[model samples]
Target: MAISNKVYAMPPVVDANSRLLFLGSMPGTASLAASRYYGHARNHFWPILYRLHGAGVPDASYEDRLRFALAHGCALWDTIASCERKGSLDADIREAVPTDIPGLLRAYPGIEVIVCNGGKSYETLDRHHGMHPEVLRRAVLKVPSSSPIPTRQHKGLEEKAAAWLAALSPFVKPRGDAQGG
Candidate 1:
């Protein structure tokens, strides 16, 4: 049987200095249950971040993870404000209502790049906001999802991490930036 339920996304993890916004499609089952993004222990999202910047992960509390991300000028959010889905799988999503992308960009004026965590997120944003190519052209980037579930589409974790790091590097300030320029 298909489990149908409304899923809500967490508030954007943002700050005045946010320079990059990472958007996922929607919170999965684990994330929704924990009321935290990427709460699943097997998920590579947090680990990837740690690998990129050598920040605390695999041990730090959820709050600390958020602090580290924000301190590095990275913002996290999901594209769909709400959606009906059976499980964590993005394919099961239906009747997706997108978050206010324009409002977010306006509110976080420091955001210079937009990174979609997976194809679902990129597709959702494109479907809803593709009409304005000019806005998207500014930086809407697509990156592999950090979910543990693997697929033929993505090679492997290492490849995915490399792509993510490359895409995010331009927008993410160097680690030394945290020490102040």
Candidate 2:
């Protein structure tokens, strides 16, 4: 498919050496506009990831947020890099163009795990491109989304955002392996 002017940007790169990868469905309106991940203010992706990885709370800047994710050996990306949606709702998407996820695997030879942010991303990824068997074998976590739209019960966090991050612990270790949650 031709790259549409409406096409949103995917992560600049999927770190090959990552042991953990957080996959969301698609970028929201805010994210597309900002050309970054988790740009929505109400979204809890940043805070949750920071708290979960013991990276301390993130600063009020996009640069810091990206640094935090990259530092933890965790890759951040979305299942559908480009999707036609009137709004941020996943259900509203029409013409979806998923990114070259397989290419990322080939490019980053060290990835070993995938953490789906929600059922939508899970279904998309699980149904479309097949992830590395080795990565899926060790960790294929299905966690909640920070998206307020998916209102449901998650682990202990109550809020989907916090719960999602907390759930990622098994796949993503803390900054130091000396402590385990």
Candidate 3:
């Protein structure tokens, strides 16, 4: 059977009030199949998020997880709008069309911080989204990938989560009244 290569069919999980934006390169095979970001069971995205913000469970429902991130002033999207790949690996990607990041920033002016989940997204943004003046103005944090696929550097979960937490610190809204009587 011939392999289906086109990827990136899901809409971004973003809202008008989002102050922080998390960008992945593109949805992986698991994410596309499940129609959810970071759907691969072994991916550390959820666990890192859960560790950073104690309010949500890593195993929470998809909608609930989206709600949790949105409620906390964050948004999620991919750098590549579409790409052709034989598998889930970023190295296999080809003909990647980047998303309208500048448009998104314009639509949501409140977005003050942008964080890239991995190197590909960061590189994509630099190559494709860097032309816009507004995009160039904002700093993009290129954190370690949370995917289960090991990197040559091999940063531990705690290290990656720490870096993510540091990058997200400025935008994270204070958890209010959690200890209420």
- lDDT score, residue 67, model 3? 87
Candidate 2 lDDT tens digits, 1-181: 7754355647644554575777888888888888878888777777788877766767788887777677777788888877777767877777777766666766665667777877788878876775545345555778776675546364333476556655665566667764663
Look at candidate 2 and give me any clashing residue pairs. 16-108
1 versus 2: better TM-score goes to: 1
Model 2 CA lDDT for position 159: 72
Which candidate number would show the highest lDDT if scored against the true structure?
1
Q: Model 1: per-residue lDDT, tens digit, 93-161?
A: 999999988888877788888889999999998888756643464588899998888867766677788
Q: Which tens-of-lDDT digit does each residue in 1-181 have in candidate 3?
A: 9777888747778888787788999888989999998899888888887666655556568888888788766889999999899879889999999899999898888888888999998999999877787687777788888888766775567777777887776555436534441
**TM-score of every model?**
0.88, 0.81, 0.88
How well does candidate 2 match the true structure in TM-score terms?
0.81
Query: lDDT for model 1, on a 0 to 1 scale?
Result: 0.82
* Model 3 lDDT-worst window of ten: 172-181
